[model samples]
Target: MIEELAHDPQSGAPLSSVKNYPGPEVGEGLADVQTQAYRTGVRTPEQHPLVEWSGTREGTLTNGELVSAQRGLLGYFRRTHRNVRDDPDPSMDSTAALALKRLKAEAPRALDSFVWYALAERLAAKGYWAAWMLDHVIARCPHPTQRVDGEVVGRCGSRLKFRPGVGKLEGVCAKCPHEHGAVDEALVEYIGDIYRASFDEEMEARLL
Candidate 1:
């Protein structure tokens, strides 16, 4: 599901103009992300932007590069949705499954970069539910990071003093603000959008 927003003739606000058309192609990386999300039960048919973009859920909005790339991601996932849902591949190697396990265990400490957030917001503005869902998953998962003492920490901050194996995260929850809630549901959608943009950029650069 690809949604393009243009100025409405009557209202002058961005209205659903291209609701009928099938938007654009989301790419393979995004497709993989969508598949992973589906297997994990994070994404739902309702949340997916396959049928129409307007009906999907809302999360952060991302525009420009991220937005364009997200469209490619949507297209790719749409194809995968059809393939996996229609025919289950028994021999499939679930790499995303392992990645999810790590993500759940590690827990990310930070949100995406400022630029990434901006892109996500733009996608939301355009009514891309997958954007919100994907971002949520990554945001909720335990972010991976290392400590000065050589041990791995889920939440790292200035207040916490991590020792090699003894001291864990003793940081103030309020001091380091990014502790939003779990959004594991959107992991696949978000990754799909990111991967599509990367692949497309590489392809375009090579052609240039």
Candidate 2:
């Protein structure tokens, strides 16, 4: 799977896609996590590369800050990916297998693996996991239509919905409002924030 994603079709040269380039949202969340770490007396680096990379300055980050961030990121990643427990899709299983294999092959050290997992957390937070799986793991695109609680919905036009009758175990969807479009975007962002923050904590631990 990694080999397939590494090649450029036209040039046939090895290709790489950047992951977890810090952005405004990540910067803000990191700052929050840093603050929490400071309050808890967690040690951090004098200058966190991620903070600098994000172009947000809230003083130097400490190891404590990274630890806090890692906790949050891992929690978020687990929750978002946990949907597979309810959905039980083979595609997700394949994606997980490929991701693990790539992680093991590429990351020689525990710290290196943490970095890769952190990047993956960011990608998943950005709601790009599905597209990534399609590009790297699955050769074909996802079906345009999805079945939610026995109702068929256009993948692009559907909004995940939770109601009384439709058990939480069974995901439900409905036509998205024109104004709302898709609520999952907000959910994804929320989940992403948690994932990124937790990743920092995990990285800090491995560094220690």
Q: Pick the candidate with the highest lDDT.
A: 2
Q: TM-scores, in order shown?
A: 0.18, 0.20
Q: lDDT, candidate 1, residue 101? A: 27
Please tell me which predicted candidate would have the highest TM-score against the true structure.
2
Position 89, candidate 2: lDDT? 45
Which digits, one per residue and each the tens of the lDDT, describe model 2 over residues 56-123?
A: 32233323211123222232223334433455444544444444344434332222113333345545
lDDT by residue (31-99, candidate 1, tens digit) is 664444334322112223332244332322222111122233333333343444556332221322232
Q: lDDT score of model 1?
A: 0.31
**TM-score, predicted candidate 2 vs. hidden true structure:** 0.20
